[model samples]
Target: MALQSLQITALTAMRARDVSRPSREQQEAADRRPLRDETPRRDQPHRGRDR
Candidate 1:
């Protein structure tokens, strides 16, 4: 049927998108890259007296 064919086409397109999505390795590689706009900030120690 025409409707069935249309559904199959839509499903195939969706599957293609899912397959092209980045894998865990690609995501890790991207995360390791530094962003151009910011620098890492150091955490400051507490100044108040504490035993």
Candidate 2:
């Protein structure tokens, strides 16, 4: 039936959408990770502090 086919198509689309989306845990883990510029800072001269 047309309605059944439409339902199946919708379900398939939903499944595909879910598969493409990251899980909440993955998102949280990403949030906890270090940023791109994150690096160990060594004692360095600061021009502002020199003022």
Candidate 3:
């Protein structure tokens, strides 16, 4: 049926997305730079509330 086909298509798309996600190491490396940048701000006395 059309609905069944649509469901299968959605499942395939979801699987594809899962497969395309970055590996754990790649994700951690990406996160490291931003965290490093924030560290200095966190250490500062005037990390304003507007952030």
Candidate 4:
């Protein structure tokens, strides 16, 4: 039905908007350290696992 399609479209648009924007905590963390690299280094060996 046309009404169901409209509702689905509205829901999809809302979800897209939500996904496009970051939350307040994320924005604050980004602001605190804008240039720091957060990724784990591949050269470092795992510390806790026993071989």
Best by lDDT: 2
Ranking by lDDT: 2, 1, 4, 3
Better of 1 and 2 by lDDT: 2
Residue range 1-51, candidate 2, lDDT tens digits: 776665557889999999999899999999899887895777999878887
What's the distance in Å from true for residue 29, model 2?
Answer: 0.8
Enumerate clash totals for all models, in the order shown.
Answer: 0, 0, 0, 0
Candidate 4 vs. true structure, TM-score: 0.39
**Residue pairs whose backbone atoms clash in candidate 1:** none
Model 2 Cα displacement at 10 (Å)?
1.5
Q: Give the lDDT of residue 24 in candidate 2.
A: 98
The better-scoring model by lDDT among 2 and 4 is 2
In model 1, where do residues sit more than 4 Å from their true spots? 1-8, 36-51
Worst 10 residues of 4 by lDDT: 33-42
Top TM-score hit: 1
Candidate 4 error regions (>4 Å)? 1-8, 36-51
Every model: Cα RMSD to truth: 10.7, 10.6, 6.7, 6.0
Badly placed stretches (over 4 Å) of model 3 are: 1-8, 34-51
Give per-residue CA lDDT, model 3, range 1-51, as digits (tens).
776665557889999999999999999988776656565554545658657
Give the lowest summed-lDDT range of ten residues in model 3.
Answer: 36-45
